[model samples]
Target: MPNQKKTKIVATLGPATSDKETLKAMILAGVDVFRINFSHANYDDVRERVEMIRALSEELGLYTAILADLQGPKLRVGVMSGEVVVSPGDTITFRTGKPFEGNAEEVYMNYESFPQDVKPGERVLLDDGKLIFEIESTDKKEKVVAKVVQGGPLKSKKGVNLPNTNISLPALTEKDVKDAIFACSLKVDWMALSFVRHSEDLMDLQKLIEEHAEHKIPIIAKIEKPEAVENIDKIVAYCDGLMVARGDLGVEVPAQEVPLIQKRLVIRAKKARIPVIIATQMMETMITSLTPTRAEVNDVANSVMDGADAVMLSGETSVGNYPVQVIEKMTSILKSVEGSELIKVPHDPPQIRTVRYITKSVCYHAALMANEIGAKAISTLTNSGYTAFQISAWRPSAHILVFTSNKAILSQLNLLWGVKAFYYDRFVSTDETIEDVNAIACKKGFLDVGDMLISLAAMPIKDKGMVNTLRVTEIESCPV
Candidate 1:
């Protein structure tokens, strides 16, 4: 019904783009979803933004998605007395102690949580790898001794980085759990987990969601660490979606390898039919300038050309002066590139054998059938966006219209290709489902009186695994 585009755009909200006017502009400029970064805003701020988005959508008679990104266990150096400048030849002491005056010789970490975590021979990076230090001696009572491996001036509360070090820390910190609960209460569409290392990380959060939220929220795993990349298959199985977080990932891994890793991540996710988003600094210069640089434009176009489901804007929209302009530019780029024949990448669809799960097989079969029939569109009523994603992977020419009663489902669909999501009340009967879907089709100009329509839905509403049927019906006439 709606215009079909392969690549979606997710715009982050911050002081620059949080206002109603800016949000409206962003929607008009083609932001498929709005990202609320919990790391920056509080509950009240997010609530207000959500309310505004809902109101704007209602006014425009358009559907949009809201993604709440949870900040997970952000590790940082505790604090320092003042600015501690260290040159190349300086030696620094990084240990737990009261704030004291120090020069190039040594510096003190005022965090009580540090000593228990750091061990001998472990490397600690300061200011996100602008400086590096190796621990020499540990004093549980006094301070630990360390020599600067790389040196730079250290400011108060700069981020700390640990590469290839196994630190014992909870996947979900207290703040993360609290924020997760709050996000569930708000009924957000997607919950992006930061710093996810393994499949168990998602399982733990899923349990917390069940216990506290009493509802299932789709988890989007953010791949910003090496561990997550190494254990990606399991993580993808456990989560609903994946995000290529290139910023911290660039810092954590070799910068030159990020592009290669991004390609691998996208390909792997495509095979599973799981939506993947390319996020962080896709167009960093748009944060200050009205237009993106040539390289940045190429970066975005290349991601779309690579078959990424979506590309996201972080600082470019969150704190950038040209938030609306950036959205417009990205939308334009996606439209232009997606229209070109070059956008079609050859992919070998995986062979799915008949499995014990009938629903899974049904989904695969329906997608194959649609492609073979050369249908103009595929429509499914799904509580999760999985069914739509499965259909999209078939590379059919048809657009996908995923209908749902849950607003959360609509939001999570923002990162999927060829998906135009709509929300309606859960159907109480088969007749209602048919009539509702047909009415929507007519309204959106997706069907004519005699057009053939394919419908897929799970029967017996209470059952979760009942999505195993497809029916083809011809539209008789327009509803009165």
Candidate 2:
């Protein structure tokens, strides 16, 4: 049996563990949430899975979160002929023509949209960069004349990679729009956007979500591109969370830099107090084998030590032969790290000398005070869920109960660490807000009668940005 840890574990859902029995087993094995990948599953499948997960959560009396990951614009090369193998010296032409033309001198790309955006000297990589091509020239409105810079065997409909070139592609394609609407309708806890290059990308998606779903869904920016890494601070400020998507990232950037980038991303997100999920290939070998490699175990443990709010399983849970075992293994690894002496290493204290955002600064102060006092729980009354994130950054031992009147805000907090959100009817006054929090604390077993608890809240309970009060109150023996 593994030791139980407070940090959350997110397991991706796939054929191996899509049924109710497997999902329940994973949950019992310590899966804190389930990820539904929209890149593979259709709307109907997602709907069914969501309903099943919801039913199981209720039956087990657990508050497991379901995250819907949107497959953003997937840029892929057009279809090719049967099979063309090119050597390093071989010059292959990528033009628009018949696929069956056995000349083999020129290979045609079936994508009609490729010629409109590609330019001369631009590099195009296919099959995860196994086949590399450099655009030599372009014909007017018809074909792209290219030669294979680095050639290998090319297959049909392989994925394309355009690094650093901003093609005129909509971040949210028609399919993405449809998927977002469906996910929002299903009320998924978190929406992870892929291939986010800039902060405006997140803003545009947010606008689309509002137009289609009529609600503010938390957007998690996937950092898989160099451009995204350059503007990561701004992007993190805008989005609700960040995901270190190392698969495409490794393809786009130098593979050796990935580990450093992962460390940087986790630290940056922690400093910003936004939840960061370490995703992609954390346990790749586990997809086939029941047991994980020693290196994989160390990888997961390192991420936990870095203060990641969650570690995501991609194919390991989605299409793996041992999905449940992989999740269980990850949970065990997290527990081992959590109970080890490494957890006691004092985290670098947050810098408050030059605080710019008052709300963020206040939340940090409140969390520091709570941690210093060794409080059993951190109670926050919030409308936007920022306070909870602030406390989560400290990685305190105390459970965080975020009381919010907005269901949207509550759903967003599902990805955060140690946050147990509860919806409350709009409080008429500040006193009512405190009372409501206390009431919830009692019901949730976080507090007992006559226990001293700390409460932090913004005054008036109506305004959005004022957290200026902290109180220490003794719980009344009887209901007042």
Candidate 3:
């Protein structure tokens, strides 16, 4: 692999790029993480993909992670008779407590509590805000009456969204639970819970993972609902990661608000020291077109300039006509913004009274030291992968070379910004380990003969504790 761009790229795998040749090209094009959306495929299909990704990544000697995005209680329209053309000012009634296929006049909702939860005069959006209706009244019984404000052709099983309704469904649906457990069995590096509304939503998923997963698998709470934005701090503290699911979020909130919301979320995630991914419709134009519109390019550039740890592609790579080309274009944009030195993430100096204050401070100062000295690399020996995130949070320009004995941790670290994880099991004296890693990093082209390096490790390396040691030295300034 060549010198990696600091900002990571994540691409989804789907029918367009299912073959070995396409998958290998995507990995080579710099897809640090491959997301498997559980909504599309069954467990067997998922299992086959997991096997293929691991096999190819190992063969290519590139570190990669897998994120299993669970499809949570997605509210959708139920069986409506063949497509109906709905016009503006048309009246529609959504019926509940009845098992009947609906037609042009009435439709059924998959959510049982839709009638109970929705209030009169609230707006209802269908199919990603294409069709909008203003609720006139809800009987709080079997039906709700609505008038179409913006109308289009209605398709069966289209998604439903009530931006104002207080939905009663748990963050994780029954299918989500089953999918999560299966993903745990496969030992995916990350799990994303969709439509997170509160901190407790993450807690529920966390508890479930703790019970079933053999090892720690970090959870990324999908920030789509307006309630999730309100509880950002709590959500950041409790979850392992955050993803701005902008497709649904942009529809739920006023469209004008999503840009600032996205920027705020990035700043908060940077402060929290957990990876943040900006996802959804990043390169939607590239889904069918040969090239992206300039607006789409600017969107990717802005995300990178906002200090987003990663930018994710959905339809462009999943079901689109051009999958590998999308990844290549996304990589081009990420590298352009990152090379321009425009990203300035707000640095939160480590605080006192924190349990891991010392470790945090070491990672913080390491970034400062690297910047002041113009170090080529910041190398750390980590057992639990804590120091990598801590160092990445400070937005250091140096290449983050993480040396870990755990191969699983190596792949998992692929999601962090500026990270390039390597494997090393030899934990002798601190100096010996430092020399070994410096040599490896040099061989890997992350360092030059006279380049400065910042090394961090825990004292008494055999214990493999949190990072507590930092050293700066020139790598091979003179022939040994």
Candidate 4:
């Protein structure tokens, strides 16, 4: 088996990493999850990548997860006949469906509700906030007139962002519906909804998934908008995971506030026992150079210390010159930070009312008990992978062994921290499950003949709410 890190790494797949050998090497380099970006890949491309990952996992006897990221409601300007350059204090008009041809006076916008949603004096950011424009007025014909506050070369099909306006748009677009169905057909482990603004946005995608998918896949909501921050608690209540998509989020909200927001989101997800990913620009400098700047290393370390389950790479692993080197560097940094004294402190779970306090208390005690007794490993039987997530959040010293009968749940466990998941059918009795766990642990070298182990589970097999049992026993003492 390949050596694993406690803080998981999620690497994106693209032109540089589409081959089988490169991907296999990345998996060996400690990549826990592979993300298929729908914005850049077609349906066929996604299917091929999914097949490759599954095949590699089988050949290597390791579990890896695939996340299909849906591009939601991305606003962009239409084509311009020629590149137009505008300077400061220049007045321009953005007319709905009006293509600009060699003129800087007016440009085309496809979003019909732009004029109705935006008001005068609101900031209009284009090309990833490179050019800033303030709305001067709006016309009855659904056009927005603005004066350029900061301007540069404007190209065709550039993205537009309304930092100060809350535009009215559906969470799921027409293309997203098709992509969601196609991804579900491929049996993706997780579906990530981009630019998720509220809890209802997640509900809309959930209904769509239920309509198409035979098995329910988990949803990962990407918090990339200011509205998402305002409704984070409610949004997190509905999704299985959360991703701090800082690329567009930094553009949508204030740049200085993003760091604090990242810490806040990680804390919220940890308290709720949900997997959270910190994504975008994690190792950006590595794309060009083999080494990352000192600040980037500290950024990743701080994210892990803040309790994020995973840190993701976008272009660094996808289209960069040295993809494998980047993963290795990331793995090294995470390992060094993990062993430092900064990570030795106790976990701080939130004291919120809506969280499952009982479950949190139970998982924390299980880890404490394992530490107190110096057990070789901690084992649990889980169906939805919830108990394993709780244990991972506590960041215990002992390795976690999770046994589940569901294959989908088994694949979903790949995103967890310090967890080695296995599938076991035949849940006849609680004693049988414990015996199986001990046998597997000993057989897999996680435990020895005389090593002590900690076993935790809910009695009666399907009992809900809190874990009801915790036992400490010698591996050789458990009856087969």
TM-score of each: 0.87, 0.85, 0.97, 0.92
Off by over 4 Å in 4: 98-103, 344-361, 428-432, 448-451, 460-466, 475-480
Whole-model lDDT per candidate: 0.77, 0.77, 0.89, 0.85
- lDDT per residue for candidate 4 within 1-480, as digits (tens), equals 236478899999999899899999999998999998888887777788889999999998888899889989888887777768999999998888545553598788878889888889999999988999999999746688999999899888888888888878888888898899898899888899998988988998899889888788889999999999999989988999999999999999888999999989987887677889999889899989999999999999998888788999999998999889999999998888774556643466536543556656667788887777877788988777778988987777788899888788777888987788988876767788788778877777677767778888777765533466788887765333
For model 2 the local lDDT of residue 194 reads 89
**Which 10 consecutive positions of candidate 2 have the poorest summed lDDT?**
95-104
Candidate 3: which pairs clash? none
| Candidate maximizing TM-score | 3
lDDT for model 4, please: 0.85
Cα displacement (Å) at residue 276, model 2: 1.3
C-alpha RMSD by candidate, in order: 3.4, 4.0, 1.6, 2.8
Off by over 4 Å in 2: 1-4, 79-83, 96-113, 119-121, 339-359, 423-453, 458-466, 472-480
Q: For candidate 3, write residues 1-480 as lDDT tens digits.
A: 364688898888788867888888888887999999887867777798889999998898887899999998898877777768788999999987766687778998888888889988999999999999999998887789999999898888889889998899999999998999899999999999999998888898999999999888999999999999999999998998899999999899998999999999998888788999999888998889979999999999999898899999888888999888888888888877786755665666887758899999999999988988999889999989999999998988889999999877888999999999998999999988888999888778888878999999999899998788899988664323
Per-residue alpha-carbon lDDT of model 2 for 282-376, expressed as tens digits?
89998899888899899899888877899989888888988778878888898778645465323565556644356666666666666677666
Rank the models by TM-score, top first: 3, 4, 1, 2
Q: After superposition, how far is residue 422 of candidate 4 from its true place, in Å?
A: 0.9
